[model samples]
Each structure stands twice: as C-alpha cells, then as structure tokens.
Target: MTLPTPPRLTLTPEELRALTTLYTTDGAWTVEEGRRHCDRLDVLLAAGVLMPVQTLLGMMYQLSPQGRLQVFGTKDLAHSLRRQQDRAYLRLCLQHYGWTRTTPHTTRHLTNYLGGRQLIEVMTDGGPALVGGQMTSGGYRGLAIKEIGERLRSPALHDRFQVILFTPRPSMGQTAAAPFANFLTLIPLVPAGEPDIHYGVPTRAQYVPPPPPWDTDFEWDTPHITASMAVRLRRDDSPLPRSSVAILCEPRSARIARFKADLTMDLAIADTQLRRHYGLSAEDIEGVPFVDAVLRPMHANTSLEVQTAVYLRSATLAYRNDAALMHLVGVGEMRRHLNVVYPSQWTVSTAGRHRIEEPDALWHRGAFDVAVEYDTGEYKLHHVLRKLDGFASRGLRGPVWGVPSARRAAFLQGEVGSRLMEPPLVTQWWLPETPFMV
Candidate 1:
C-alpha cells in the first residue's frame, strides 16, 4: 500500500535566521554575497523566496514582503508595525461595537471573530485610500463580500452578518463609499476627542472628466516622454538609499492646471535668456518642459500630491547625494515627477483612471527631504496628520508645512508636532490675495 505523503517540512531555525538577515538589511544581494553571506541563501533562492531587484550595482536579491512573513511567522516585524496604534484603535472600535471573537480556526480565510452567530470579516486600513489596491474601500469590499459568501456556505453561519471596513481617516470627500453603503459598512476608526465621524454619501458627481489640453507654440523633432514615463525613468535611474516622505499643499483644481501651464511658459522664457550662459542647446531647452509634461493638462488633488512630493523629494535627495549638485525642481516639475511613484500606491482598478494627487511643490537635500504642504487653514489637525501618516509609512521623516499665515503655522507646528517623534517644520508663504489672471 502507498504510504500517505508526509506533511511539507517547516523552515529550519538556520533558514529562518538567514531570512531575518536579508529582511533586516537594505539593498540587493549579489550572487557571490548570497552564496557566502548566509548558509540558507541557496535554500531560499531555490524556494523562490528571494526576489531579484536590479540596482546600479547589478542584480541583487532581497526577501519579498511575502517571503519575510513566511520566514518570520508573524507580521508584527513587518513595515506594517508603523500602523500598530491605528490597528489597535480599530480593534477598540470593534470591541465598542459589540463584536466578539468566538472562533479560533487558523484557515487562510479565518474569520476575524463572531458576533452572536454572525460571522464578521474585518478590513483595517490606517493610511490614505479609496483610489485602489490594498487599502481602498473597494479592495476591502471585494474581500469581505467574498469571505461572507464563503462563510454562508456553513449552515451554522447565515446571512445575518456584516463586514466592517475601518480606515483611520475618511476618503477625500466622504463620497467614495456611497455607491456601496447599502451592501457594507464604512466607518472612520479614529479615537475620541477627534472630529465626530460623519457618514453620508457626497452629493458631487462621480466621474469628472479631465479638462482639455492646452495649445502649444513649439513642436520639436522628438516627441517628449509623458510625465508618467519621465518619473518612472528617474526612479529606476537611482533608487533612494532609504525610502522617504515629502509633504506639500495643493490648491484647487483650476489653480493647479493654471500653475503648470504658467510654469511651462516661464521656464521657456527664462531658458531663452540663460541658454547661452549655461551653454545649453535647443534640444536641451525643449526637453525640460517635455520631461515635466507641464504643457499637458491633467487634474490634481491634495492626497496624491502628498505622495508625489515625498517621492520627488526623495529622488532629489538621492541625486544631490550622488552628483554633488542640486537640480531646480519646481511646482509643475514636482507634479509630473509624482506620476511614476503615486500610481503604484493606487488601487489597481483606479490606477489608470485617477488624476495625480496635487501638491504645490517638494524639496529634498541630504537628510532634509521635506514635503512642503501649503496649508490654506482648511484641514483639521488630525485629518492632516492622517494624510502625513500615510506618507510616513512609505519612509518619509517629517512634513515642512507652508502655511498662508504665521499664526496658523505656529498653531500647526505646536499641536501637530507634539504627537510626532520629531517636530514638523513650518514656513510661511505669502499667497497672492487673488488668483493671478492669465
């Protein structure tokens, strides 16, 4: 008789130690280093646990997020540890709402807990969301719905259950979950003393088409790479020594479009004067705005801008460190630079369709990578910090806020800084009294 196959082997302590080494260290591992650095490298490499990342140094291996979780046996050590407080608050909310843990099965689709015979699927997010991928309402909705159906298959658990989708902050306008509120519950998972959470579908129309493109004067022989393409090239050209966050404020959509168009015109005019001084060619001058895609009309929002600013600042910091020179990356240039970095963070379904989160600008110099948020005195301190926390999760340090008034800037720095490990930097930008007419 054929003997039953033995259970797959568990990872040896030696293998786990090797994985911990790769997980704790940053940068790619060379083939020679991989073989010699740790005894289990060959085992992990054969197990498809190490992923290849192409760097300036060459091909190197690093433990993928999944690989790390596999060897570590728990997610507590992952970068997700950054949001532990938020997750704890989410648990508090569930406890407050009377949800209880009744079952303890370790299945892949393990139900979080049970409440009076109803199975609950809980999706928790502590970062900016609603645009897609992992943290959005849509992503959680799909998972919860699928799990609900699976649980209903058990005759003991019926359709009396509800899925709780918890986010530390609300969506951009409190409208992202309107379309599906009937099917699920969406709630902000903040602690007491913060703003009272509101739960109404926004009235604004859902699908806003982008404004028309601007007309241009010059047509060069070579077509410019799209802004998205340019940003990706910069990211690949130099990976940051460490991940970072940059902050910046964004005005309304109309103002955002006008600023980009004006920057393109101003840059072209200034380049004409400085071309000879800098000994640059026509191709070089033309390529500047082309790379930025400032001439292209696109929508921008504050949320996405925050993500972009972090990336642009990080890229600038990396470049400055390597070249010993600074580059002039302005408002419009920063917007274009975000195209590559922010899209990946977006949910897969919304990635191509959504506009870049708009920001006024970003700055990166050595250890001073900062997101320059332009505060219009509109955001609540807690709401603003929630957005910043999203950036911090990606490896940013501190926000350098640009407030319209000194009094408000001081208030923000004091109130917001007390909560953070390092105080936020504040600066005052004297915004124009009225919108600048074209």
Candidate 2:
C-alpha cells in the first residue's frame, strides 16, 4: 500500500530552516544535531525530507536526494566526491579509450615520479599519455604550491609522456598568482616501456646509418633515460591482481567531507573486467581522482558545466560510431561544440533587455529555439520568480526552467507556473547532452 503524499507540504518554519541548513551543508549531521529538530524528524521523514542513517558515530542525517532536489532544484550533491576533475576525466576515459586506456594486466610503477606508487598505465592512441595518481592535497590551505614540487620533481620522465599528478584543487580563483605548473611529457624513441636505448657507440642500430638528420631517438636526454629506467623496472611481476594505488586522496572541502561515511566504497575499481578478472567486488566501481597538478578549480555555478562538457563530448563521440544514436542530438546547421549564444542567435532580438537576459543553456537553430535557466534553488525565490516572469513575458516556447527538486517544481508551479501565459517547463536540472527537444 502506498502512503498518500500530500500535494503541498505543510511544515513549521523550523522544519523549513532545518531543510535549508541540511541542503547547504557539505557533511552529515550527528544524532546530536537531531536534538533541535527532535520533534519534527518524524514529520520530515514522512515527507521524504530527512534521511537518517545509523552511522558508526551514532545516527546521522543527510538530506534525501528528492528533498535535495526539492530544495536545491537538482539531486546532484554539491559535495559529491565523484565530481573531481581528474576523476571525472578518468570517467570520460572509461566511457571511451580515446580519453584514456588502462591496462591492469601489466601494471607498472614510475621511478622518481610515482615514487613507490604503482598505477595502471594511462594510454592514448598517439602513444603513451600520462600516469596519473593522487598527490598530497592537505586541505585547501596546505595544498597551494609547496605540495606539488616535491611530487612533480621526478627528474625522470619521458619527453613525450607527461608525469601527470592529480590532487584536490583549492576553490576557484585561489591560485592566480601561483606560478605556471611544472610538468613534462615524452613519447619514447622505442615502443612505450620498452627501453632498448642504451649508452652506446654510434655503430649501434639506434644510430647505425643515421638519417639525413641524426636519429633524434637516441638523444640521451636525462628525463627520457630516467623514464626508461622506470619503465624498465616499473612492472609489479607479482601474480596478485590487487587494483590498489591508494585510490583517491580525500578532498578537505567541507562539501565532500563525509565521503568516508561509507567504508565499503574504499578499495574499489571502476573497470568491470578488472574486477571480474581479479576476483574483486562487483559491488562498486569507484575511480581514482587524479588530474594534472597544474590545473585549477573554477566557480561551480557549473560544476555541472564541466560534467556537461564531458557528457556532451562522450555522447557526440558515441553518435559518430553507434548507428542507433547517429542523430541523437540533431546538430544540423548549428555548431556541434558548446559555445555561449547571444541575442543575435535568436530571430526575435527586437525584445530588447529580454534578449540580454542570460540563459543557463540554449538550444537555438532556426525555429528550434529553447533557452533554459537552471535553478539550484540557491537564489532568492522571488528573484527566480521575477526572472522567470520576465523570461516568459518574452513569449517564446522556453526559457525552460531546469529545477533541482520536486518541492521547487511544486513551488514554481504553485507560483510562476500559473502566473505566465506559458511559464517555461519546470523539470529536473539534469540536462541532456543536448537541450532535450521539448
């Protein structure tokens, strides 16, 4: 039997405050936190707002996904550990080999660079790409510059292959004054990891009948030679197939602080074959969070923007080879890449300021114009209502409002949904690669 869900939630002001507080928090709350809301917990749970888990530290409460959507306008947790750039990039790799290729059967260690750490090689079509892993991300403050040099200085990497190191980044715009990130790449003269190059006389085959130009292959570069040594010795000939390299460093951001709330997630691999072959768990596929140390974080009005970009790239690439999805997004005369479109793209530019009004995303190509606005439920409700009102007043099919949760949808419907001649579509903010052609 289904419990009847009320069309409108009738909550005390304290309950609303608790919901807002939990929604914005990066970590979970202890049962001690339950004290203040003790009386109201049952009500919120019945309404699908508060989800209390009996943690090792006693009972803790986290906002339910639906409640988060209702509050934030989307279910995507702001503190999701999966959103790290390096990890996300690796996810892109798993979606397709072009992004990266990992070989668990032949795991290798990097001398000087990866130190004692052993990670599966990250490969590319052109050649060897990068070997990425976590570096010390000692919170946001300790993670600035000092942490990287000690890690980045392998002094032993190839010229063509980069020594890729990843760490959790400080918040956006935090490192403008920080120096250019030090890094290197090397494509070996021989097949990657096959170090045939040696300190040799000019008579050797490597320099035998030198080309019109000297065989650049045997330049005897310091980085390359050292890289060869690592490649020569990097292998873990041990028969055990443990997919471990201390997978991911915990980011100190308060947002994802409680990732360890689930201990079983540790020691997991994202590759299915690796797990089955290695006799590991099918329970989880958590990837390592690793990206170039040089990269920086940006404002997250769009942490989803980064995710969006990756999703679009992956989806479009699939359409190219997969017959069933060839015209999945219908990128006809319009640009295939994502670029911000302006009032000029719309035929009805005569609307003045409304044309200047910003859209979170737009699907415009001749009559297929649908401008979208994403509300995380972060803005003042009135401001959102006013923005939507002005947008709808323009009288196009959209200016679709991409909301996060059900309550937000209800609120929009209760308020703006009825106010406009054609209020924009209020749906979950999980955008498709393309603005879904509604």
Candidate 3:
C-alpha cells in the first residue's frame, strides 16, 4: 500500500535563488521580491517546499525541511535551519512565560571602560534593559547587585534602567538576596514542564516549596517584586504537580526573555561537548546544526527542544548522579552514518521520506545506545511498534521512549524493556528556596 517517493533532485539555479531570497530575508519575502520571483515561489509552494508564516512585519516565507535540504544541501542547510529553529523556539518559550519582545534586538556601544563593545539590548513587557554578554570560557558571571547600583549612580542616565542577568543561579544567594531582594529579581530558567521526565532518581525531583503568602501591605518597589505580586495574587492557591523546574520559577516577562537566551546558549554548548566527546571534530560538524545534528530526533519532528530545553538545566542539576556521562545524538547523524555505511538501503529517498523510521533521539550512555522516540500522548501502540521495528531492521535496538507518567512508563516497559529507566523530570535546581521575587 506504499507508494515510492520521487527521487529528491538537486535544486536548479532558479530554485536555489528562490530559497535564498526567503532564507536571507529571515524567511520573509518582501512583496517586491515576491513579484520578481513569483513563478519560482509559486512552484515551490505547489511542491510543498515553502511554509508561509504570517508575522507583524507581513507575510514571511520559510523553507520547509525538504526545501532546506534540497536547496542548501544538508551540509549548509543544517546551520541555517537549526538557527531558525532556535530563534523560533526562544521566542515561543519567552511568550509562554508572558514576555512579548517589544523591540528587535539592538546593539549599543558603551564607553571604553566597558571596552566600547556593542551590547545587545532587548525591550520586553518588564522594561528596556541591556542583555548580558555571551558566556565565556570562564562561565557566566552574573550581574552583581553592586553593578546595578553603580549603573543607577551613572550621571548620564539617573536610575532609569534595569540590569537583567542570565546565570544558572537565578537567585542572589541568601547573603545577597536579603539586601537586594527589592532591588532586583532572580528568575530561574529551569526547563521543567508538565511533559518532562524528572523522576528518574528520587533525589532528582526538585522540591517545590509552598507558595509564598501574598502580602497586600508589603511595599512593591522594583518591577520584579511588583510582577511577582501580580502573578501570586492572580493565580489560585491549589498546587500543581511538579515536572520541569520552570514550573517553580516565577514567569516574569523579563525572566522569560532572559531564560530563553540563557538556555539557548546552554543547549548549544551541550551539543558541542557531546559532539567532541563522541569523537566528532569541528571539521566533521561543519554544516551539521546543533539541534538538528546533536539534539536531532528530539527537535526534528516536534517542538520538544524548544519546549523542554529546560530539561538540560535539570540534567545538569543531576550531573553529579547518573546523568554525568549522558549525551544526546541527533537523528540526522544516525541517518548519515547509516547511509554512508549502507547507501543502498539508507539513501535520501528511503530515509528522508519517512518520519516513522526516524527515531526521535539517539540516547548514548557508554556503549549501550538506545534509539528514542518520545511518547507525548501522540502515538498509539502500533505507531510505537512500527518505530521499534524500523530500528530493529537497521540493527538498532529500541526507540527507547521517555513517557510522561508512571502509568505510561509501566505500560511501555511491559511492552519494551524491563531495565529501562524513567527519564528525570525537569525540576528547578533551586527548589524549596524562594527566589528574590517570591
């Protein structure tokens, strides 16, 4: 009952031009470009090569995965496609925590004392602020309370701006917390969410403390405190079950944007580390994108990377335990490896056309690797069986799944493997401890 998919042909110059126009313009084909390349664009649309995404700027055209692969060639396309996905993922996560980016990221030059370097500035629902610089080899040094106080004392500006920090430790520890509790807020970007697997080890569960009592009489001076007050007063008292650490963190608008940026960097570094650990050199990883190449099957079919990026935060929190040696391999890498070794069976037509055959993720731990397919309540038993069957044919063992609940975990093990361990939930690292805001 299956029809053979047509051979994916190389992109002609005209086709490549169309894809480039969309790609370079950040997936937005201005009306002028559209008119000039209308014929080619039309062809692409008919062939399901371009996906139209509507934005405030007007209509934008994004290359479908097939379009990217065919036009840019997988090598070059991987970087562009993964970056596109990363930005989209960051924006969505920011929105989830109530931040609507008010302005496009802008760069401002600071004085020589700060090295005259360009700093990235972002405006959100909270306020206009300067984003922290990218993490360096020394790791992220959080924005200090004294630094904010100094900026407040700056003669050029008065006390008008807020300093948002993107550090793993979102809270100013007890020593600093009490003093600057009203001055600044710490929002943890724990990627814990309802669908995350945070229960692998009992100790891995980030303790969720009882909600802080809303104080009507308390003075709310800083934006952070004010925002926390609003959220606490607005929500119901009933506690929700713990999952991703993000659940415990306050969802301030600024926190959301900062979290988005911070986690994006963390995931990027994790991919590089995994690749190098697995013996992949920089030359070997040239065109392979981070999420697509390393975080592959997880980010391929669904928005799992964007949704559970905080999972890395949880994984890091548990690194002292079993997750220390864990690494996530992308499905593209697996496919490429399979094709290079057995091109007759794993060519583009056969491997690229089918998602069922593609494992959601390749979980590598020492010598025992498992092909993973996440069960987010979207697949039936037959669907899962087929994925397992496909992996088996490739001399692979499982699409070792990470289910959402204990009940589902039990069912899967009964049907899959008895030794399978439950994936950990995405719990916050600073659980049971109140952040600056709440």
Number of clashing pairs per prediction, in order: 14, 15, 15
The runs of at least 3 residues in candidate 3 whose Cα sits more than 4 Å from the true structure, single-residue gaps closed, are: 1-67, 71-86, 102-120, 131-159, 165-186, 190-438
Task: Output candidate 3 Cα RMSD.
Answer: 23.8
Best by lDDT: 3
Clashes of 2: 15
Model 2 alpha-carbon drift over 4 Å, by segment: 1-175, 178-356, 365-369, 389-397, 404-406, 418-438
Q: Which stretches of candidate 1 lie over 4 Å from their true place?
A: 1-77, 81-86, 98-139, 142-193, 196-349, 352-438
**How many backbone clashes are present in model 1?**
14
Q: Count backbone clashes in candidate 3.
A: 15
Scored by Cα lDDT, where does model 2 land?
Answer: 0.34
Residue by residue across 1-438, what tens digits does model 1's lDDT show? 222423333577776776676555323345555676667765665555665532212234566544655776643334321122223334345554555343334222334333232333432342111111111121233344345334433422333333445544445323544544444356654322122222532110111123334423343333123345335534665211111111111122332233334333222112211221121223332222211101101111111110011111112121111001101222222223333223223111111121223223334435544454444455686767775775566464444454434566567667886544334323211111111110
Candidate 2 weakest lDDT stretch, 10 residues? 290-299
lDDT of 2 at 308: 15
Native-to-model Cα distance after best TM-score fit, residue 82 in candidate 1, in Å: 7.8
* Pairwise TM-score winner, candidates 2 and 3: 3
Better candidate by TM-score, 1 or 3: 3
lDDT of 3 at 261: 37
Q: Which candidate, 2 or 3, would have the higher lDDT against the true structure?
A: 3
Model 3, 289-386: lDDT tens per residue?
22111122221233211111112333333222111111221222232222222222221111112366666545444465556554544457787678
